[model samples]
Target: MMRTTTNSEITKGIVLKAMPYKENDQLVTIYTYEFGKLTIRARGSRKLTSKNAPSLLSITQGEYEITLHNGLSTLIRGTAIDYYQNIKKTIEAEIIANYLLEYFYRYEEENKPSLEHYQFLAGILEALDIGYDYRIIYAYINCFIMKENGVELMMDGCVVCGNHHVDAFSLESGGFVCHEHMHLNDLRLPKEQLQAIRYLYKCPIERLNELHLADIGPIQKIFEYYVDEFCGVNLRSRKFVKSIL
Candidate 1:
């Protein structure tokens, strides 16, 4: 059996990257406003004085309509609705955005589009569209990792030995520890930071802007523990981001 392709138009997405191709063309990966993720070729976009070049290269945000034909997708044209140079100017925004791209490409299952993940990225991008806030940004990402991995860490009580006066959180046990289960080497979080993390797990994304972290250091540490132990691979860019920040 033979399959044939059809041409169509798609009005969605934000350009994620513009990579060189041959002599005069470029390849673009867009986080589509409609389809989630898409790739398209922009023919002759590298030529000097080409009108589409600037727009295509600068199409960092907003929706776009692409032309498709004969199994080829091209950025025939698009208009910029909202854009900010803050992402490029601020190291925090840049790293966060790149981390997002890496996370999506690494974990997002193909042919399986999740509106939560898409919406989460969109929300974080909106937050980054403004000035950089390192702690807030990292917290936003840390909580997402938990949901993405389905690791519902018990925040209120110890997973190994339930205790009301829990002090230290144990990565191995999935939550805080009672005095009996607490190890001398286990990380202990201050009361306020522990509460901050608990609220983050329960907080809805829409209301996250109102949530405040008493301390991002411990939450970030806790998040790293989970990613290292469970997710199995640490983001290489994480180090770079920490260095620059």
Candidate 2:
């Protein structure tokens, strides 16, 4: 059989999800530095003798050779980059890592490359691999993702009145609100929690390791509310991570 080499490109990417396809193939969803998110079919990847099988695992980073044909892209070859092996050492870490992948997969658009966002995801995965506190990493990554997407919470003041003294966060209003403007359903966030969010908003992604918060529950709730109301994503992996925590 003669092989055609048209439309082939090589890129670095991380596998977000890989599922069995047909008899001896795998369908992979990858987030790449050169191209945002892509769904590529891996031919003959299910067989034990396949060389590309190991690199297709979820959260595995690698370089991929992809060929596009008939509007569908197929991964022709792959080389393992960073498996982040430490992240798979424990169930909790795995769940959190999976949640991160799911969150990005749900929100990021296909074929629109944002190098900053790509680097942010890569940095967070590296942090996870190096044994950072999962909760802190989760909160920071959520905030960074939201910020990158331009839907980050307004921490400067009340979204409605611009008041600096905020008593609660109104998910419907999309920001913090003063006591006078607070809705009945708004979540009452403590001053410390508000300050923490403010810091996260301005903090650099690489400097996230230096931050320490005694309680992350409030911040996590804020992020969840933002994701649900704005991004319209309900991540099952997020729920699973919470259950085991």
Top-lDDT candidate index: 2
Error of 2 at 25 (Å): 0.9
Model 1, position 54: C-alpha lDDT score:
55
- TM-score for each candidate, following the candidate numbering: 0.82, 0.84
Off by over 4 Å in 1: 1-7, 54-59, 67-72, 161-165
Candidate 1 per-residue C-alpha lDDT over 21-81 given as tens digits, one digit per residue, 9 for 90 to 100: 8999888776664555666788787889666665564326655657644344667776654
Please give the range of 10 consecutive residues that has the lowest summed lDDT in model 2.
1-10
Q: 203, model 1: CA deviation in Å?
A: 2.1
Each prediction's Cα lDDT score? 0.67, 0.81
Against the true structure, candidate 2 reaches a TM-score of 0.84
